[model samples]
Target: MDRPKPCDLVLTLSLSRGRYGVRFAQDPAEVLAAQSLRHRAFFSRTGQSNASALDVDAFDSTARHVIIFDLASADLVACYRVQFLEGAEIAQAYSAQFYDLTALADFPGILMELGRFCLHPEHHDPDILRLAWAAMAHLVDQAGVSLLFGCSSFLGADPLRHAAAIGHLSARIAPPDRLARAKTADRVALNAFAGMGTAAEAMAGTPALLRTYLGMGAWVSDHAVVDRTMDTVHVLTGVEIAKIPPARAKALRQIVTDCLGYNNTVSAMH
Candidate 1:
């Protein structure tokens, strides 16, 4: 795999009305800015004041950090941590800390795990989200990743509180049966929602980040695990990029072009 190039170039992306930019965090301070953004979004909302003021973990060392910045305000609006899974290192992957990926045991290609995804609550413009995903598509191409997987979180840890969304994913959204199981002792069974949760309700409780994953034809696990530290309920989610519909691929390619500039390789965009 090619080593990720360090970048600090300020990108300007054109929009129908305004503009935004995407940049890879090139230093610890920039990464810390991303962490602070996450800390602000996840902690304050969840009332987890006791947790550290920064959202961080060991994965930050091994992961590549991507951030979307508002060119107008020059503030980091969103962030995601992506790690390439390799060799015995798979045992230490961030997702492995919560779910069982044994089903991918036979898969023989590069896989990237994405995590620490969050957007500043005050910034809800879809352009920021588009920039983040475009950066991700670039990362996936550069690393030659065939599969992208990670944990997508909801506001709170209580499964019943997220029953509608959980049920919807279990009912109609899933990875191949072999790859979507969560192996937690406290995992709530999706079947437990029979006759209770509805798809509409599920959509109501689902977070925007997870919703994006679902739209990409990603699948979720059978259950969500309560994360006390983060004060959120999250499930394992994965998408096979090769399986994305052509139209979706085209949309991502255009976004990357707008965000990263048209000079990017056409093969990478595809």
Candidate 2:
């Protein structure tokens, strides 16, 4: 397979009413800024008080960072770290803690790990979310990635508290083919949340991020893993980009088009 060109590495989108821009991190300053924004939004106020401003991990050395900046305030609003599968990076995928990856033993082509996703709470505008999705789509298309995987988090460690939500995910979002079924890491099964409800009602009371993933054809693992670093429970999620819902896909494309026009460029990496 041919490698993605440098011009295909980043994307930029602009909105009509409000200003929104999505692009890849070109320097260490931008990456640090994105990490600071994540710290402020997720760690400072949330129960995960122990998290440090530097959210970098094993993936940082080889991962590419995508960031959305609010043009109006000149501030970083949202960020996600993506690592394309190759060499050692493939051996250390982030979702390893929650699922039995061996099930995907035969899956072919390149894999991308999406992790450390976060948005400044104050900038919860839906446009920002749309722009981020657009950036992701562009990246996947450019890289020719076949699978997008990540560990999505729930607020607390107690599954009982989020039983309805977990149940809804299990019912509505089916895993991709049989090859993608989520396997518990340590033999822990999600039996208690097996038959909860629809994805809509289950996540009605939860955060917007999880809901967005469900809308984009993401499926949850059968169990949650305890993440002491974030002080939360997380589930392995996988999405086949080519299979994203039609309506949502169209919307994301529109957002990307709009942003590219505003920036007076066909692509961000250019």
Candidate 3:
């Protein structure tokens, strides 16, 4: 697969729902807005409140940033970054930094690595989450992305704090042995807590974003990386597009189709 330009992976499209709009970052300011939101969401507890409190890394330059904003206030409410990769390009993915995903490097299909997904500390509207998924669905279809992978984070650096949630992933959606390996020096084996909690307790403890992935038949790595720099424990998660349930896929596509139709109709009227 030849390398595509950064612009090629981004679609010239914008989606709106209620008072929020979703669009790919078009300039540094927009991308910085996303970084700012991520900083607040991820680093508030660490007191990184200097003027340069933006959460940024090398991957930011190579990936596309998706920003969800309030139409009325023009405030970025939620954001995430995605990097498109062919099987051969798996090593360049953000998740690759923490997990040994060499197994997926030979997998046949395009993959998208989603990272730094977060909502504004003050924005709690459920529609924000819905809009995020809708935008992702559109991107997946447009790019022909066959799989989606990322590190789903838990709030603390301690795995025991999220034992039930990690255990649930271990018991229900642990990836096959061929997918990922525990490469991070600071990592906890998920299976150690697989039987520590009940399914109900597990679901309650799981993060919302991860729960959404699991609902779509996603799976996770065998261990969780204890990222002390970020003060979070995370497991590599992957969702094979083909393995998603038919009903769930339909619902996601319906969101994309409806958003497109609504936007087109509104455009035509003007």
Q: 2 or 3: which has the higher lDDT?
A: 3
Q: Which ten residues in a row have the lowest lDDT in candidate 3?
A: 261-270
lDDT of 1 at 40: 88
Q: Give lDDT for model 1.
A: 0.71
Each model's C-alpha lDDT? 0.71, 0.66, 0.83
Angstrom error of the Cα, residue 42, model 3: value is 0.2
Weakest lDDT window of 10 consecutive positions for candidate 2: 261-270
How many clashes (backbone atoms < 3 Å, residues ≥3 apart in a chain or on different chains) does model 2 have?
2
What is the per-residue lDDT of model 2 for residues 7-74, given as tens digits with 9 covering 90 to 100?
24444323332566776777788878777776776677555444355666666776788878766565
- Evaluate residue 20 in candidate 2 and report its C-alpha lDDT on the 0 to 100 scale: 67
Model 1 C-alpha lDDT per residue in residues 1-270, reported as the tens digit of each score: 664432222232222213556666777778888888889888887666443578788888877777776665667778888777754455667888887777765555677788888888788888778777887877776666777888888777787787777777775446474365566776776666655666677777788877877778887777778887787788888887888888887887777667554332111000
Q: Record all residue pairs in model 1 with backbone atoms less than 3 Å apart, i.e. clashing.
A: 164-202, 165-202
Lowest summed lDDT across 10 adjacent residues in model 1 is found at 261-270
* Model 2, TM vs. native: 0.80
